[model samples]
Each structure stands twice: as structure tokens, then as C-alpha cells.
Target: MRGGDLVVRVLKYLVSVAFLALPLAAQADELQEAPAPDAAAPVPSSSDTILVTATRLAIPVDQVPASLTVLDKPAIDRAQDIGVTELLLRTPGISISRNGGYGTTTALRIRGAESEQTVVVIDGVKLNDPSASSGGYNFANLLAGDASRIEVLRGPQSILWGSQAIGGVVNVVTALPAKTLEGSFDVEAGSHETVSARAAIGGKTGPLAWRLGGQAFTTDGISALAPAFGGKEADGYINRNVSGRAVIELAPGISADLRGYYASSQTEIDASTADSLEYSLNREFVGYAGINLDLLDGRFRNRIGYTYTDTDRDNFNPTRARAQTFDAAGHNRRLEYQGAFAIAEGWTLLAGAENERSRFRSASPPAALATPVPAPVRGGADITSFYGQLSAQPIGGLTLNAGLRHDDHDRFGGKWLFAAGGVLNLPTGTVLRASYGEGFKAPTLYQLFSEYGVASLAPERAKGWEAGAEQHLFDDKLVFGATWFQRKTRDQIIFNSCAATSTDALCFVPGNATTRRQGYYANVSRAEAHGIEAAAALKLGSFQLDGNYSWTVAEDRSPGANFGKWLPRRPRDTANGSVSYAWPFGLTTGAAIRWSGKTFDNAANTTVLDAYTLVDLRAEYALSPSLRLIGRVENLFDETYSTAIRYNALGRVFYAGLRGRF
Candidate 1:
């Protein structure tokens, strides 16, 4: 049978199974609803609700305008058995592309969007590296233990956020101060000689509440294929990370949060022996502080935050005489103020303004010239933006949101962006939503000012629209949603071959033609991507089944370019599903599978990465109210596959650990 036919068959079987189990699932639900005379007044379950930061405004997950997914604390702990990359690989409509092992450079693409287009935020602060080829964050080095929750929002978010939000947003929110004294400590040892320890404490003193936490981890990564020509035994690398955070409640309506992290790793490049000759040592340190205040009779709110990050890399390549060393540093600071008030019987208004500034710098040694060259090149860029958003609820079950932003940079010119969206709630517990927005991304310092034998570049821009619906069924036991979206980008920075014409030979002219990318990117054409994302979570007695599927069709419409071709590294179809059973004995067993359809490796779609699937199994046993034992087997079938072409992927792995709370 053809691939399409197989897919249809599989889908049909799944639908049939779901229908056949409906009766049993319904009976289980009825039993759950049976009241217990002494059930303590039916207290609310903590797992029933989740809060998200997708809107910069804290709101319940179901109320968010766009498609949102929240991995809460309990979920995070259970998945901690695997690396962050592996856990994210299971998310719907998301894909991770890796260059090598766990700690190696990694990128995330959402809904056919490029890595540079996805924005990553830690505690509401953007973490894009200005010194990188593209202003994008490296997720490989992030520590998952410090996050209280991970919120993934799909679709363009430029109006509320600024640049680098063309694809979507991933927000990692850290733990906050608790009202009661609490503490926890955890330690784990697993495959690949991995070991880690973490501890946290929280307490309240009169009007003040505070929480502090720290973690340290180390690992010896798995082996893989070498890069370059003629490489060997691609193994033997060490990765280490340390992080800490603290939150303080200064008053009843005021709070401050401070966090610091340091991560360093010595890893071997999976290149040919000639390529392996280059060993890399990377080190990074980050510090941040934020303040929040609620005032004006609880109608006005304000937040101020600042962050500083420094990353240093020392690469020794035997093939090249000049060892490449990079000292990159960046700082981000922002201040936001918002207020909301009731105007009439059924009307409410919300408004906010934000001021943000970002700066980055990098220094690297220039490669040796055939003869002799001048000193290395050094430069940096600064950007400042002002933005505001408005939200109104003029009638029951109807909400309208609009936002605008202006960004001015010392390097790139100015950009103005805006978005408008609306949500309608039906009487049957369903919501319909639609949004249209504009997005912009400034050229990286490297793209604009890199001294590649003298070349210049320009910035990129995007426009997008999304429509979706969400429904709650079986009295909220099941939640389902579907969304369709499209985005078009302009002036996409690209490297074009330069013509060779040397006027002066005194500079020791290199190859036939000195290659340099031109900043003259044009609005060649447009890229259209439309997809349907469907997700459902059903709670049956003590068992839960959650699954999601995304089908996408992306085409490049630029004239003379790879028109009609699928975007590189984007899967046309993706799906994830998990089934968990919780026993009264305090044990939970679950298994999950993730699958991605075939994808292209380049814009022309000439080379394809075959479709693949991964399976993971996890079990957790509650030793007590304060401690638990968790174990998991990842890549259970030991399938060997590549998330990116020519990149090494982790093989079968197992982890066992213990977690506790007091």
C-alpha cells in the first residue's frame, strides 16, 4: 500500500479503538462522579488547572487566545529522567534539530518556522544570542530543574513581543515563593555516567515569603558519527551545569526575583579525525533580577527586569593555525506597566506599555591570510523598543485584543508592528479565535557587520494570521482544539555567491572569487504554511490518555527561488500520544510515542530525512507524600535516527532517580 493509504488505515484504526473504548471510559467516569460521604468537600485537584505566560499577562491555559501547552511541575519531574531535548521532541507541532550529542548546539523549529524565528524566554526575559549567526538561543545548555513550568505558544506573537517571535514563544517560568515553609532535595545517577543533585527551600515570615533553589549536574555523552572528512570514534565528552534561583515577597502586593546560572562543558566535535582535531570548551554565566508590583486599588500592575549573560568559547582546530576564540556578552533590560478598569456594566479595558533595550558584542580571531592580514574585526549592536497592547471585553463571552510596537536599533533601521485578535465563547463551552499580526527580526551583528573579506547584510520581516477553535467535553474531562495558521517573510537574509574581480593584488586576494553575503535581501516572494493541529486529553477513572496530531503543508513562493518546495527541516506531519494509569497504591505507569513524517534538508527539497518514531516509557512510585522514585527508558526500541541530517542522535538510554518534598 502507498504511504497515504497506510496513514489512512492507521487513523481509521485509532478512531475505531476510541469509539469501542467509549463505553468503558464512560463507566469509569460515572464511578468517579459517585460522591463519597466523607470526601472532604471535594477539594480541587492541583492538576486540573494550569497558568501560562504566553500573553506576558498571567492567565489560565484554556483562556489563552492562541494554541498553548503547559508542562506543569509534576510533569516536569516525571520527564526529568530524560534530557530537555528529548522531552521537547514529544511536543506536538515541534521539532528539535541537533548537531551532535546532548550538550552540543541544538535548535528548535515550530510549525515549519526557522530556529531564528522562534523566541525563547526565561522568566519573561528573551534569551536570543546576538553573537550567533542568527539571533537565536541555544537550548542545549539550559537546565530544566530551574523551571517551574514550560509554556509553548504556537503562531506569530510579534505584536505583544518584539523581534524573533515570528514563529512562536517558549516561556520557562521559575518557582516562586510559597506561603508555607517547604523544602525538597533530589539526586540521580543514570546511563552514560550521568549524576545530578538539586535542592530547594521555601518559607514565609510575617509579610515576606521567599524560596531558594540550586542544582548541579554532569554527564558523559554518548558516541556518534564524526563530522568533517575521515573522523573516528565519536565519543568521550563531558558536560556540566549549575544553576540557582531565589524569590522574595517584599510586601503583600510586591515581590522580587533573582536568579543566577553557570554552565560549562568540554565536548568533542563529531567531525572526521581532521575535524575532530578541533576540540571545543564552552562556558556561560547568567544573572537576572525582576520586580513586580500591584497598585491602584489592585487595578494597576508594573514589572521591571534586567538580565546579563556572558558566553565564552575556545575552539582549537589543528587544521587551522589561528585558534578560534569568542567572547560574547549581552544585556537585556525592560520596564512594563499595565492597568485595567471597569468602564460600564459589561465593559472592561486593559492597557499596558513596555520599554526594552538589548545590547550584544563579540570578538573572534581572524583566520590566517595567504600572506598577512590586518587585525581581527570587532563590533556590536544595540536595540530599543516601545510597545503597548489593549484588551477590551464589551460584552459577555467576547474579547478583543490589539497591540502595537516600534523598534529602533543602532544598526538596523526602524520597524513598526501591530496585531488584532478576537475570541468568542459559545454557550456550549467552546471558543472561536482569530488573529492577524506582523513581525520583524533585526539582522544579527554577524549578518550585518561580519568581516568576511568585506560584506554587508540586512534584516528580515514577517506577517502572519491564525484561526482556531477549542472545545471542552465530558464536563471538562476532555479538552480538544484545532488551529490553522500561515506566515510570510520578506528580506530573508541569505548568502549569495559573489563575483570575483580583484582591483588590488596587494591584499593577497583569496580564491577565484572572494565570497561574501550581501545585505540586499529582497521580497523575492512569500512562504505560505497552513496546518491543522488537533489535541485531546481524556480522563478515564484513574487513567488518562492525551494525544495530538499536526498536519502541515508549507511552500516557498519566491520567484527564481525554490518555489513549491517544502521548507527545510520541517515535517509535513507530526504526532504525539501518551497513556498513563494511576493506581491507588501511589504508583503511576505511562508510555508515550512521538512520530515525524519525512522532511527536506534544504530549501530545494532535493535531500530528504526519512520519517521516524521514538518511544519512551516511565514509571513513578510515591514512597511518601514527600518523596518518590522515578525511572524511565527513552528510545525504548533503540531506534537509530537523525533529527538533523548528518547529525548524531542519542541511542537507547535509561535513567532512575529519586525526588522528595518536605
Candidate 2:
């Protein structure tokens, strides 16, 4: 039998098994990073804090069975990082690679998983560009504009989030009005003629609350290709963004919400590893509308919502006759209903159903006018899903959860996933956690119908398990944690290259024996990953310290020449550390260090990516209760480095800004 036939048989078996265990995954999709109506706000210094990303319902951090990191406004401001991706790098279980400086193509991977496997959510709306090669969100344009909190949930999370969540989830919650009238602003300028300015205003009145914000940033950046590669031309970048959110009361226990986010960016790129006068334009829009209602005296809450996302991308090469090289657009629309019911004091049930539709159209224009632009490749897919989860506390300080999700895809049909985990919090200030999760990723539209696509590809599947422990001492002043995790993936999708003398049946385009193809999407037999993550935080008097380390070994374990080789671009070790102190005179100073081990640049492990370290210094002075002056020197030592081969990393740069809140 051929590869396609074998995939069909396996899928049928999984579908039958999914239907056998359908009802256990009952979890709501409310995604309230903030507390629920009845749950009180979390105190910054508390050991047990509330978070909702794990199960999409408010729960304390100790009760969550997975590893998670929360960055509140104070932390975000103190870090003084301009990009959200930069902020995430300080946390555990995450790694990043960028082609150049700000506003360049970026890849963020979690726990050794592929970049496309992670899911990004903003204010309860999912983000991805289906028209892209891998159908993933680019962190290049994602900034920390007007964001109050951001959560990083590591590991497979497809039980609550749907497909493409094999790695984990990044949940970002923007600011919401809390006072009758409030506002804030920030302005900064730094090296390379970089300037950034942003402001926000919001207010809460009787039955209405609203917030609006905007940001603008520009920089003359370093070369896309490394200076070591004989590249010297500068590449510039600019970005503009706007966001708004509103909640209106409709009745005693009901309300409606409207939210939107828009961003436009332009970045100068290069021709391969050489300098060239080329550039790209990108735009992203996210909109959501929802209504909330409560019944049984707030014991049960329900929400119905609609979300839409659109991404537009274009590339121009001035050297070409037409200049315009690529154009693409992707759109996603989703209708969902979510419910959360407090079955009892320590027991809860969450459920949700959703229908998501994705469409994409793309084309590459030819240089010569004699030939017309090939008819744009257009494709669309729909996924209808129902999921549920149950959590209960049968004994003091012990919480357990189980969940299930079933998805019916227009192309792949039915698939189901299951997850179970437990957390034990002891009176001795120690917590133990363990979990098992299942994940899957359907082939992207581009992978199935594009010029080099194979229409008969199957979805990839993965399973992972983790165990960890945490200890807090001295009234939560000193805390440390570590986790060990392992995962296996089957039928991983990869691009297969056909050699000139190859005789593989797949070398020829379908239905045309004479037409040989250079490359096509195919499934890898297997892959494996395992790692250890350790983190600690210390708070003593006016001084504080935080640090994390990761040891990841992701390998291709298939029965081929590449077996046991390290996966591309995944370092075996990475670590981050920071220390800060505050003086009695309203001054705070801090320094940070980041280090990474060497990594392979390709699947065959023939190319080597050297490791490097960087240092940074930051300081802040409080002018008043609501105002402050901030300055930071990034890459303080001007250490030259590269995250991706032949790509230059930012060197020494300085920035100073004023922040105000009211």
C-alpha cells in the first residue's frame, strides 16, 4: 500500500477511538486571565495566585497541573523589553530566533516543539496566518502595547485549545478600565534613530467600561545578514498599532463586549544572505464581539462570541522588473459558545462548542510581463469542535482535572484528544504536579494545495507527560521549581527534497509522469524530545533575583540517516538570570544575562550555529506616585551573536523614556 492509503487507515482507527471517549473533556473557553466576578484580585506577593489559561476558568496557580509563568504589569515595565517575544525569552521552556533586528521574521518555539505548533491568543482571540507556509503567527509585529498581563503555559494544550497547540499557549490580556477615569502614556528614544511612543485612556461608568490605545515605533536596524558574512547595509523598520475594548451592561447578570486590534508594519529585508534593496509590508486585524450571561445566581456562566482575524502580506524586490514579488491574504472566522458551572464549592465543569472557518489566497508575480501571474492558489477549511473538562478537589490541597475534545474537520474528519492532571499543595509550602496530554496538528492550507503541495497528507499526532515540584520558603520570599518532561511525535510533516537522479514515485507531480518536482511536503516517521526546566526567584529586603535554565534534547528518531540527530536550531542548553535592587531614594537598578549552547542549523546536523551570551543594564527613578523615568542599555557589552545562521543580532543600544499613570 502507498503512504496515503496507510494514513487513511490510521486516521479511521483514531476516529473510532475518539468517539468511544467523547464526553470527558468538558472545559469552558472563557479565557479570563483576570479574576472572575466572584474571585478576588490576586496580590502580587502571594504564593498562590489565580490564573485561567490552563482550563479557561479562574483557578489558583497551585491547583494548575501544568507549568506556567505570569508577567504582570510591574514585571513587564521593569523588564523594559520592547517586543513581547523578548519578554517571553526571560521565562523558562521557551527559545527564540530572529532573522535580524526589530521587525524581522521571528520564530518562537516552546519546549523543543516546532514554532508552528504553538498557539497565540490576545484578549481571547486566536491568531495565525493561514496563507503563510506553516500557518503560524509571526512574532515580528507583536509588541507589548497596552498589555497589562501575559501568561505562558508550556506543554501540549490541545485539550482546551484546538489543533496547532502541540507546543503550548501564549495568552495576553490587555488593560481594562478599573476607575471612573484613568489614562497612561510612554515615550522613548534610543540608538539607530529608534523612537517609540504610546498612550492609553480608559474609564468605567455605571454600566459601561471602555479603553483605547495606540503605539508607534521606528528604528534603523542592523543588517539582515551578519557582518561576518560581509554585509554592511542597514535595514530599517516601522510599526503602527491601535487597540480598543468595551464592555456594556445589558441586564442584572448580563453584558456585551466589543474588542479590536490592528497593526501595520514595513521592514526592509535582504536577498538571501546578501544585501539587497528589498522590503515587505504586513498588516493584521483582529475583532471580536461577545455577550455574557449568568444563571443560577452566578453559579453558572455562559458566553457566546464571534471572532475574526485577517492578515495581509506583500513583498517587493526592486531589482525585479515588476518589483512586486509576493502577495497573500488569510482570514479566520469563528463562532463559539462557552459555559462554566460551579458544580460545588471545590468542583467545576466547563464546556464549549465552536465552528471555525479559515481561508487563504496567495500568488507570486513573474518578472516578465509576457507571462501572466499564475492563478492565485485559493483554499479553505472548516473545523467544528466540542470540548469539556471537569475539575474537583476531593481532599484538602489536592486538585484533579480531566478533559476531552473532539474535532470534525472538513478534510480529515473526526479526531479526539484527552488530558488528565493533578496538583498537590502541602502545608509545608511544597507543591507536586503531574500531567499527561495529547496533541495534534492538521496540515496547513499551503501544505495541502500550494504549488509543491501534496493533497493526501495526514495530520501529525503527539503525546507528552511531565512531573514537577515547587518549594516556597521564608513566607514566599524564596521560591524554586523544576520539571522533567518527555514527548513523542508520529507522522511529523516535513519538506522532502527530491534529488536529480532520484526515482521516488513522489518525485513527479500527481497525474503527470513527465513533470518532476524538486520538493514536496511529506511525513516524517517519528521524532522525540525530552528536557528539564528549573527556575528560582529570591526576594530579600530591597533586593531581588530571578533565574531559569533549560536542558532540551529534541531529535529526529526516524529510521533514516538523520536518526538521533538534533533537531534544527534547538539548543541543548539555555539560561537567563537577573538581579535588581531598590534604594530608599526612589531609584532602582538591575542587570540581566542570557546564554545559549551551540545548535545545528539543519536537519542533517552539518551546519553549526555558535552559542553566545549577552548582558543588559536597566535603571528607573520614581518622579512621583504616578510618574517615573526609565533607561536601559541592551547588549551592554556589544557582544556580537547570531540566533539564526548568517543573521546579525542587535549590538549595544540605549533607550530612555518617561512613564505616567493616572
| Global lDDT scores for all candidate models | 0.66, 0.86
Assess candidate 2 and give its TM-score to the true structure. 0.93
Colliding residue pairs in candidate 2: 25-388, 25-389, 25-403, 25-404, 26-388, 26-389, 27-350, 27-388, 27-389
Best by lDDT: 2
**TM-score list, all predictions:** 0.83, 0.93
Off-target runs (Cα >4 Å) in candidate 2 are: 1-48
What is the Å distance of residue 138 in model 2 from its true position? 0.7
Q: Write the per-residue lDDT of candidate 1 for residues 374-414, one digit (tens) a residue.
A: 45445566555556566666677887778787776665667
| Residue-pair clash count for candidate 1 | 8
lDDT of 2 by residue, 1-662 (tens): 23244335434543443343233222433322212321111123334455554347666788889888988888999999999999999999888889988999999999989999999988888889999989989999999999887888888899888988888999887887888999999899999999999999999999998999999999999888888887799999999999988989999889898889999999998755699789999999999988877755566666767889999999999888899999999999887767676665677777777778899999999988788989999998888787888888999999999999998888999999999999999999999999999999999999888877888899989999999999999999999999999989898898888998888878888889888988899987588999999999999998999999999999998888999999888998999999999999999999999999899888889989988898999999999989999999999889887888888889999999999989
